[model samples]
Target chain A: MTTQANTDGIVYQLRDLSVNLRRRGQDRQILQSLNFEVRKRECLSIVGPSGTGKTTLLRALAGLIPVEGEITFQGQKLEGPAGDAVLVFQDYGNALLRWRTVKKNVALGIEGRIPREESRLRVDEALEIVGLQKYQDSYPWELSGGMQQRVQIARALAMKPQVLLFDEPFGSLDAMTREGLQDELLRVRSLHEATCVFITHDIDEAVYLGDRLMLLSGSPASLTYELDIPLTGTRSQISTKESAEFLRLRHQVYEQMRKAHGAAPTTE
Target chain B: MTTRTPISLTKSGIRGNRRHHDGKGVAPMIGLLPIAILLVIWQFLGNPHSVFFPLPSHWWTAIQGVEQQGNLWSSILATSLTFIESIIVAALIGTSLGIALGSIRWGGKALDPLLDFLRNLPAAALVPAAAIVLGTNTKMALVIVVLSSIWPILLNTRAEIQNLSPVLSSSIINLRLSGWHRLSVMIGSALPGILLGIRVAAPLALIVTLLAEFITNLSGVGALILSAQQNFNSAEVYALLVVAGLLALAVNSLVSAIEASVLRRHGPST
Candidate 1:
């Protein structure tokens, strides 16, 4: 377990963070003593088995829920939802304002905080980053699922927050659309270098997107494994995924997931 | 990509459905064809000398009598004024109370049974009670109108507020929207449901206003219709009934137009 002593370039420092939720009149421990440091401009992907409190952990980090221990952002303790951290929800259909146009939906995060002209400019720039400039006037329902998700991303980008929290954003998307969005996300991240905390159940997606991968496991979930990706340069869907390093990292994470699930790890 | 095809197809599908919904321009005129036919048949076959039934041609003379008596415009104006005032009051009180109750769990639970009881009390039945309590006055009429018609708006607004999506509420928090902004967004999203409630309430307001006037013998279209019936002026009664129907139709169309414009501007809920 890594201690909280390492504070250099760390954007978020979680110390003995624990979260317990009441379910069916019984208090269930969701996250227990979670300790990790998310660095600046780093994409830290949290991959775990289903119902392992991965979303809860993200929600706590975003200050959407009450937790027991210390969770600090930029050296200040996060008490509640802050403007510096924006969460992109998994259900885009409900997350994106259906009544608002794509541009207005993107502007929702910054509409009143800034001047009208500045808000419009930020919205335009965010839409441009997501390659959704042409669909600015279209409603969310009018757009495809992938495009709607991009609108959600555009909304977060428009806010220009310090940290982007994604909770299985592309989980509902089909394979082709998900792959396309994954590439688009990489492109956007490269342009706008905000620290990202992406929570997903897909091991491959975690390895593909994360600068450093964290595996959460156990009933009262805690960070069980953390590994820095060996790849240093830009990642492509085809070549990077086919590379020996990417395959090795992916296998290692899968083995850890199997071990967490109480099953004998298979080499194949 | 395969996804592109389905998206375009869905767009076209929406367009196709909209076109089907709009129908041809003559569809409305076609719908009115039956009413026109009924009027024409009545005009040709009705006898003016009948004590119970009068010819459609006698309607104009009956209206002329009402105009001569100086009650035509005044009755219409009185009825309309009561209807407008009642609806406005009902909308304000209903929406405010509904939102308040919906936002607070204890408030909703505490008032649910009382509200349901009041809602079940019929507006027509309240006419006699209101006249006895407050006497036959515009105030009593207005009170009856509001009491009977406010339920739909209140109930619908409350339901919509309760059904508000958690995602949108979370977004409001994440965006750090102020209380006013949050409220406006909440109201905006709930507008469709609120307007739907208002749509039902508006006609009911008019009906209750008329019923109150009839019971109270107050100054309105309903009183005029009642007096005509007592005087055995069958033509006048029939003419006033047609006028009431036209008034109701106009009110309904106006409300529907407002609802359509709002839904268009805000976009319907997904």
Candidate 2:
């Protein structure tokens, strides 16, 4: 286990992090003893089965919920929701301010923190990054689902936070749109060089975007497996997925997921 | 492989249908055809000498009679003044209190019973009490109107605030929006609900204002109608009733116009 006292390049350090939720007047443990370190400028993907508390872990790291164990960000204990991190939700319809235009929605995150002129420039930059410059004046509902998710990303990007937390942001999109956004997220992440914690249920997405992939399973879930992709150079949707090494790593993770779920092997 | 239809295609189709329906400029006038025909028939069948009902032609004479008495414009001015003042005061007080009660859990629970009792008390029943306390003045009339009409605005605003989406709240927290910025966003988002409440309350306020005038017998359209009835001036009584109906129509249209514009500007996409 890594020491929580190490601040160096780590954006987040968790030691035995646990979270309990109160449901129907009963205490239910959702996350149990999570130990991990999210390094700077790296995309960490957490993949799990549906309802396995992947979002709960992300929320805990973002300091949006209470944790029973130690979690520190840049050497300081995370007490609550900090200003240096921003979360992008899965539901773009509910996340983006419908009453505001694309520019205004992006400006929402920074308008209170900076002067008017600077906020406008930051909003434009964020919109430019997401390729939404042309639709800056359009309302969120006027845009397509993919575009609306991009606007959400722009809103978070405009904040220029050191850490970005995405909670299955592409889950609600169609397959083609989801693939398109996955690549866009990769480009934007590289451009900003910000640390990212992307949560998803899709194994392919987890392996594609993550610098390191972590699998979480079971009730009161904890980290079950961690793997590093050995494929070198820039990752491509077609070439990288077809490579033998990528296939091997993907198969290994799938087998581990089946094992974690206590399912019988498919072969006789 | 199944080819999925793009979502935008269906969305645009729905919008096109709405636009096609709204493009018929003469539809509203067509809807009023029955009323127009009814008025024409009444003009021909009404008896001029009838004490209970008068012909539409007697409207001019009744107008002259009220003008001759020098009470026509003054009565209108008094009623309009009370209605306008009461609505403004009610909107301000109701919105602030409603937001506070809705956003703060403890505040809402503490005031629930009191607000429930106040909401149930009929506005007409307060006229006598207000008149007794305030001595039948414009202040008493204003009080009666506001007390009766404030419930809709307060309740609607509170419900909207309480139902504010969790995503929006989380965004506010993640952005670290200050108190003023948060309030501005909240008020802007809740404008549609607040305006909806005001739309319902406006006509109710007007009715209550007139009721208060009729009960107090002070100086307004309601008082004029009451005096004309007592003196057996059938034409003037009927004329005042027509004017009251027109006033109600005007107030309703004005509120509807404002509600439409606000919803267009600040409401969620249809």
Candidate 3:
């Protein structure tokens, strides 16, 4: 797989990004003052424990929710859902149109805007990328959990977005499936040259898939720790993870996470 | 706890799973057993000399007599036609209006009180009013049936549309789907609910159709039953009543079959 990413320009720049949501007639802060920049063609993994507003942060970045501070996509203020950004939700079952065939679901984002022939080709190409070409005629539920999530990814890829926001896309999958999909995501990101912001609670996965990893934790989450992973180029699940650098980074992240959770460190 | 034999365990465990898988196919046939038994009992044991509780065979003979007079087929044809037309019209109106009201932020909520009052007015009560306005015709029957049946479809569609999953809704927006494309997706997402509404509305439509026909004395099976009663031909009355029940059964079966077949590709409704 090609590892060179054109990581010169900034794709997303957030300034003092705070998001408050109204629940049962009261405003609750879900994300506190946050600032970050995602470089082009880089995968930025945001890790946090569950219920730490990881999804809320992703939604704000996608321009799907109102926020209190400034957020810009490609230097433009995002007022609503950005046309060049697509969010692949974790709930693949709910994200897919069960009634639509795999091919049709992939074509959903581009059917009307693109020419019919072009749309068909794009759908075919996306299916090819996700290795779901065989299941094009099948409905989503007919496929396994991993395949359904691939279908969701294919749908987003067909849009040919400059940015792909994944909300723990493999969180519902089994261990083997998640590892396979992690590699698949890395390969796809390189091929598409798309900027990605992946949210997950899995430290190993974040380290494996991300170019830069940031820890988002707290009652109302904000970026608490940031690191640039030293390992690059094509990474296999076994060798890269077994490397000393990978272990050191993983240990550091684990300690930071324990600290974020307010747990006392164990005595050596 | 009692110790179970290995054979019994297999029967309850492995075989039980298979039975559960096959339950849907077998249950409907099993359900008909009681009705079949009831009919057989009535045929053999019921008093043939009774006025109101005529034997099942007498019902068949009375229906044959009506058929010999040539009114039976025409009445069946008219009632079936009216019911089918009413259902189609109601479905169209209900689906479109439901989508409209459901799409708007304030539309469904703002009109809830008015819709509640309107839908609560019974189809039977409106039959006379409709007949007077449309003059005891098929058109009037159509109106009454549509009015009564449209609610289920409308409300179900609205509720389904309004309750779209956040992820799915966000996907739609992110994909930049708008105009007819967006509306079509909305419709597809709400299709299971729309079909659910149709299933609920169909029987109600059939009932309203009969009510309009009977009250207006229009030409249909309902009229046949009315004439049979007025003439005090208890056997014919019983036969026509059987015919009405058979019609209801046919309608319910047809709607359910359609729903099942259509939703097969869509997966289970829930």
Candidate 4:
């Protein structure tokens, strides 16, 4: 099921994006001057220490956070919540509305602007793409954690977004379930060829999935440095994680993060 | 006796329930014995010639009188209509106002005090003042009922819509939903709260209508009860009171069932 990206290659362009949250008349710049670009069908993994504004950065790019920078989508300025980017929240259970069945939640991804029949068709097709065709009518609570996350992914896929932003979507699941989901995510994403940006603290996840990995510093968080990961073939938690190159990249990312946090590394 | 030790006298009520559930069918009937005993006491206390309550035999006759003469049907019908009219009107107005108030960020701060002042005014206290304007009829009854029933509906609905998970609000904005469309989602989404409010308002409708009837000289079950009391016809008074309680129960059950259905339809599936 091939879909079209809105642009020739570039999907979302954020130039000098900075988010400042004001509380009690005090200015707290959460993220400052975060410049990034997400190309079509590429995943950018943002790894940082906790409270480094990684999540806020994604929110800003998705137009959820109010920022001063010029954030453009398909050559148009994104002033507010726009359709080009879909955000997958960390809490998959809370993200999907419990009032709806799996099929209905997926259908919401298509939105209500289309004709009812056409929207239903798109919803059913999305469920199929996510490999949950048979469980369309199942409620989310009844499913296992992986299935629930799949339903969420199906909803994001239903939007047919040019760019997808995930805020630590798999951060809460068990080791086995989390690994399984990452596989499912990559599999379905490749099939759809949708642009994606995901935030995580896991170094291995950064190396495994991210085409470009950006590490952020803490408190007045800014992008310190970004690296490009060039790995081909089936990427799974178990298989590629043991590779020499993957470990080296993980080591590089960890060092950058430690430096950002201002922690002195003990030499043995 | 001084040297003797005491045993535990505490009755494990919940434990008894669990044991009872494990037993045969006969064990369940014991729960109803208390209610049966209470009814017997009520029956004796309510003897027709008794000083306090009218007799059951006397009430049977009054009920028979209404059934035989056919006018009982009209009077009951009249009262039920007025009661229902006031309640429906209140529900519609209150639900609408609540939804509107709930959406605005400062709506609660703006309207809470005013609503509190009006809702706290007491339905019965409003009788004399309302009677002066409404002039002793179904209109007066409806006015009282509306005042009593509308507040709970309005307040509950506001709480439900306003307190929705912030994420859903973001979802609504992200999707670029229109104003009317947003209300449809929010209202239906607020089913559990609105239903509970309606259930609360339903009983108030009956109570207010009964109280309102006391202010009016027109046809109603309240009017019948009043006349009976004036004439010292205790049996008739008791009989009319019975009918009123039964009517109230019926209305309460109807509203409850409707609320349950709506909740199931709109609420997240368990």
Instruction: Indicate which candidate wins on TM-score.
Output: 3
lDDT of 4 by residue, B1-270 (tens): 110000011012211222332344354357557855876777777554675565566678977876686766777898899888987898899889888888888886777667778887888889888889877777888888898888777887777667766666666665555667667667766666666677778888888887777657568887777877887777778788878877886786677556555544333333
lDDT of 1 by residue, B1-270 (tens): 221122233234322433332443355548778988998998888775787888877877998999998999999999999999999999999999878877987764677678767888888888888888998999999999999999878877776777678887787788787778788888877777777778778999999888998988999999999999999899999999988988887787677666666667554334
- Pairs clashing within candidate 1: none
Structural similarity to truth (TM-score) of each candidate: 0.88, 0.90, 0.91, 0.85
Candidate 1 chain A minimal-lDDT segment of 10 residues:
A1-10
After aligning candidate 2 to the native by TM-score, how far in Å is the CA of B238 from where it should be?
2.6
Colliding pairs, model 2: none
CAPRI quality of model 4: acceptable
lDDT of candidate 2 vs native? Answer: 0.82
Lowest lDDT sum, 10 consecutive residues, model 4 chain A, at: A1-10
Q: Model 4: what TM-score for its first chain?
A: 0.91
- What DockQ class does candidate 2 belong to? medium
Question: For model 1, how does the per-residue alpha-carbon lDDT over A135-202 read when each residue is reduced to its tens digit?
Answer: 99998888899999999999999989889999999999998898888888898899999999999888
Model 4 alpha-carbon drift over 4 Å, by segment? A1-8, A22-27, A109-111, A262-268, B1-36, B44-48, B69-71, B265-270
DockQ score of candidate 2? 0.55
Of the two candidates 1 and 2, the one with more favorable TM-score, higher being better, is 2
True contacts kept of each: 0.57, 0.61, 0.75, 0.20
| lDDT digits (tens) for residues B65-159 of candidate 2 | 89898999999989889999999998988888878877997664577678778977888789888878899899999888988888777876776
